[model samples]
Target chain A: MITFSKQQLKIPKLQRPVYLVTAGQSKFDRAFPDKRTEELCIDSFTMAAQLLEISPAELKTYIHSCYYGHFADHFGDQLLGESVIHDRLGLDPLGNIGVKTGGATGGSTIWEGMKAVASGYSDCVLVMGWERMDEVPTDEGNFLISCAADKDWESPLGHIYTGYYAVMAQRYWQIFGKSEDSFRRTLAEISVKHHGYARFNPYAQAPMDITVDDVLNSPVVAYPLRALDCCLMSVGAACTILCDEDTAVKLTKNSKNKPLRLWTSAGTHTLRPADRMDMDIPLLPNETADQYKDLGERFPGGDRYPGFTGFLAARVAAHYAYGMAGITDPTEDLDVVELHDAFTISDVQTYEDIGIRPYGEGRTYVESGDCYHTNPNTGQPGKLPSNISGGLIGCMHSVGATGIMQTFEIASHIWNRWEEFHGDENIWNKFNRQKPKDWTNLQVVGAKRGMAISHAGVGSHVTSTILMDPDHLINKDA
Target chain B: MSMFGQVFVKNNQYKLKGDFHHMTPNMPIRNADDEWKLLGVTNPRAMTYMHSYGGEAVFFESLSQGKLMASRCDNSDCNITGTIYMPFRIHCPDCLAKNSVFDLTDIAKKSATIHTFMECQRSGAFNLLDKPIKFINIEFDGVATILMSYLVVGTPKFGMKVVPIFKTTGPTYTILDLAWVEEGTKEEQLPEGFSF
Candidate 1:
């Protein structure tokens, strides 16, 4: 398994074009004591139907099958939770299956649905994901999250998942970061940016208008990572419907939306990061071997591939996705992205992994003002805005629902309905959250293409979901 | 008298003893508002799992005997033969051949160095490690993969020379039975139940 064969490295191709017609999400919060998971799911499905300008029952008629993504049965204390949800959603006497790939469950669910539509097995498939973390307290929730790790090897250490990621942050800090004060500040700036963006997102769980000072002063969960740097433990549901070209066109005929092409490609590495072997960097289309030849010389202790400083799975996923979508460079080809920012430091790592920035220089992506809604340097739009939905850090890390939530965020931008969904006074009132006076529209103008990267523990599983306007594809046949 | 759950394998079948689960009544969770209307209930239960280490059981069992066992991929037909795995792989990843187990204690003591490390301030429920656990990933001279363990004494930095310490007195038969500390430390300075 050290060296990949040509068969294993082949770029995936869909048999027929697949499209994401519509998507929706429920209000995300750390806990939802008043509502059950099924109720939240119904809310998301109802919203999806509303987007299509159809009744929930009318939309249900188009769903030939269902793919449910509920990561932790332990958290819900229910076995076959997918069936329970399927029954509650009233989609019975139809084929349905469950998908679980840790935090990537949502993306993986959509991936399953995409394949179903691509192969013509189902014309339209319902991809719904939800998580109920409210049932357990904080420490117990952390315990359950830690169970995703190698039970015998890593889980026995402290039963804390943060400790597992903290080791990587420490390595990336000293090596790539050079343990500099500016680099630490750059990490804090990410927290400041995400939390600032959250104030505009009605569904975001931890909205704040905090400064870099506040993030730096926040209580340290681990050195180099503060509480503000971590993603939220949330409860919510999100969903998207995928269909073949015919079904997509029909579904969006009357609605103001258009069918967007969706291509999902996935990759995985060792569950235990310790087992990740040193390998050649799986270069993206935009990268060349000469660029990383001196990586070790520049950073010192940075040449180790898939080392604690990097995520091989993310790099592999991006490699497949870029190839499938004909993206030579993500910075140019893709307008926006929603990366799995489990930690602020991991967010920076993903920038390099996904080729938004070169290795040992992920800070440049933030420093250059390319990842913001608007460049702080100039009043112009940022070249590549990421996590406009506040991402997992400021938004919600509702595990199963997170990737679907991210898809909803990016799809809304492509649909040019960002202000409609996020800035609507009705939604703010429904959630009982007061909209900020200075709420800004984060819609990426002329966004023809976007992507959402869903990831699991320590680079174990990752999927890249690329959505593009059918009229504008880098590879026409794609 | 109530006893905790325990199990053992006999003739390829698990034999259980004592109570496997303890159940408690569900308590109503009533809202303080709206005249204390019932919202939900809390379900409380205590359970223990009988986990089998399988082929890697030797690695856990050896910790109590003051030995570190590593597996060698001896599949001659494999691409990466003779590669040693420190976390004790039961089978060779390249060829799926059963790995040959060998004592890695001496090499670990003489050549182990910290590859990366972290000091964690928080832990989840049911964790046995003390607060501020000094987590360290160790690299050996010839091992292919790093081994994640904890430093029992002294702060950890990159490439700090260390040796493994075993909880030989009262072993938990788990990874916690093995720990690490700086080299040249006195035997008397070791933690209770742990020794060089």
Candidate 2:
């Protein structure tokens, strides 16, 4: 009964061009002693401010508004962090926003910040997502997350977060006949690949040298899902500042730097119980129809429904990002991707959902190594190297913090800033700008058309497509 | 709906004596023949009467003890028979005028049976238990009203006979003195600790 018309749904048009000028994250860990949520937030914000070469006071004046995305501990007292940092650094803002979308809170916050800039409501906005889940006991933390689902029907039925994903796994097996062994192999490979990437990440929580065998042999928590298949419970924070193109130049010139332009971002919500639909039926205004109709038509099948990992809502969101970015071919166009791998099954599901592989063919993409860090089959290289920053498996999923972590990783990779800590220096140098020490050197390489996709662990699915022009790195392309 | 009327009787006089009064001989009728002749000779315009007395008085006087009891028809060929009584009583009301005899005893006091039970979570002043309570109905030795009370056992099972124990708190004379029943044998029970 409650619906929005096209005109009412339309967000206000912004006269100024927006750009993702800066992004930063704190060290991901299981717990930080004496670390409050506000401190973690301030830590992330301070890192971004430092990266932009601007004091919090100078940046505060430019920030028209601010949004915070967080769950678990210190939710009601979030302003304390903003006020503390504001007082310490002497910064003030015109408006502030807070979004709590269960586990997807971080991704939802990014979408909120993007909309605020795109709508011309504010010329610049600061967005941050942080969580201190480790402060509570594990069961209590899980209870908080489970609160996101339907309490009466789901929780009372002893449905944990894992059980929700387990149902999806069961459905996948029933529909595609994908055996548990195949799922295990794909999951193990995904975990090992992310862990290998994490070894290069200084902020990853569970960075380790794990193997496919390790993931397969790990203890099974739920049927078809082993211990390695699950993401680590992490405590950390991530932050980003968005500014219009003209302001970005003035600020860049004043600070002698470049900016990450604001690309198209899209978000959609499907019916809560995704399983209620017939498998063959198409989800309306899904990522494909909503964002990628042209690409859907271009494919030989003439608009086929993409089957995804039905666990997390991220797959649909990632698809939407591909569409909004006008990516006709993911294998040829997309250079890097980051997905919320809350569980191993999620990574496999994401592969199919994001159109990296055909329906029921995500396993092949993994086996072929196109979705891995190192391609063993082609000897050429993987195309869509996914969850390269160890993902939720290595990075730890502090429900509220994981989504933004994915965005920060993609932004960092596209900016060519990954090698400041990990990965091959020469390889990263190809994507890096000429000025190695300069912050602008973090820009994406030959990335005239770029897209970043993120799915919230909960039901809020959002895909953000960021289109950046190397020429416009210093100014607005439009 | 059955239309019925009641007329009270005190001694040998009809209490309803205003418009339809009746006179009776002071001498008591000693035999059924004399009682039938007295009833037949009553004027058509005279009011009829029935005597009613509290069951407790007869129970104490006849049985000399508090008891759970029932009533039975004294007629020789009556199919309509035994009906359970509460607080004990003498004489079956159904056959009182016909057979004119009554038996008062404590037959049920020697044994008890469980009828049914239910578990409940509601609790308050109205509930016997101050917390989540379970109610059970036991057909006690010689009482009616099923001796309803809260079950004291951790777990209650069907067909479990429990003997009723009385507590003298609040108003002792009231039936509220009857508390929960517990599992025990007749040999383990004792008479009222204090005289009523």
> Which candidate comes out best when scored by lDDT?
1
TM-score of chain A of each: 0.99, 0.80
DockQ scores for all predicted structures: 0.85, 0.01
Give a tens-digit lDDT track for model 1, residues B24-73.
99999988877889999999978888888989999999999999999999
Clash count in backbone of candidate 1: 0
Lowest summed lDDT window (length 10), candidate 1 chain A: A1-10
Q: Model 1, residue B32: displacement in angstroms? A: 0.6
Which of the CAPRI classes, incorrect, acceptable, medium or high, describes model 2? incorrect
CAPRI class of candidate 1: high
Q: List TM-scores for all candidates, in order.
A: 0.99, 0.60
Interface RMSD of 1: 0.8
- Please, what are the lDDT tens digits per residue for candidate 2 over residues A1-478? 1123466334333445567777767767876644555666777777677767787667777887887776653323234444544444344545665676666677777778877887788778888877776644565455555555543223322224554554445445434433456655766887887776666666777766778998878865544556777778778888888877776776666442357655544445432342121123233222243444453343332222322234224444543444344455566666666676777666666666656665465677778887765577866546667777778888667656676777666666655665553443542343231222322122233333345455553335555545454453322323
Clash pairs, candidate 1, are none
Lowest-sum lDDT 10-residue window in model 2 chain A? A433-442
